[model samples]
Target: MENTKKKRYVLVSKTVLVERELWTRVRVAAAIEGETISGLVEKALCQYLERQAEKYGP
Candidate 1:
């Protein structure tokens, strides 16, 4: 059963499929920065969406 109680926003797991080459690059960058691949991806997605909103008129 689904919970009906209100709650604060919380981080949740998500899956994304990418090319192996792209993932290799991300792995290297993430290792250098000492951050998980998911964290890097989330930041990148946020920035990309923000730029798109600015360019296309939110």
Candidate 2:
């Protein structure tokens, strides 16, 4: 038998205040991409961090 397990992450809820127009744009983009706002934000943040790491060493 093989054991299949998944790593668990502890996620925290956060409240962000953005401009109404910006929020609407994000919502539309998320809908177009078939992703939740949270997922889009996470992916954007990860990409930003990767770019930053490349610019300034790991």
Candidate 3:
């Protein structure tokens, strides 16, 4: 029987570009944190949403 815990997420892919220095910084930070660039970007976007919500609460 297959172990359910062995299943993996099939990540959907996308691409975006940044200035060279920022790209370098992101790559270094991702590597240091053992996270993919996508993971870092996703977390950044969630944080951005939180800040916006705080600024414009309903």
Best of the candidates, TM-score:
2
1-58 in candidate 1: lDDT tens per residue? 9999754432233555565566678889999989997798888899999999999996
How much lDDT does each candidate structure score? 0.76, 0.80, 0.76
Q: Pairs clashing in candidate 2?
A: none
TM for candidate 1 is 0.65
| C-alpha RMSD of each candidate structure in angstroms | 11.1, 14.3, 13.2
lDDT of 3 at 22: 70
Instruction: Give TM per candidate.
Output: 0.65, 0.73, 0.68
lDDT tens digits by residue: candidate 3, 1-58 = 8767643333234445455667778889999999998899899999999999999994
- How much is the lDDT of residue 14 in candidate 3? 46
Q: How many clashing pairs in candidate 1?
A: 0
Decoy 3 TM-score against native:
0.68
lDDT for model 2, on a 0 to 1 scale?
A: 0.80
Best by lDDT: 2
Candidate 3 achieves a global lDDT of 0.76
* Backbone clashes under 3 angstroms, per model: 0, 0, 0
Local lDDT at 19 for model 2: 59
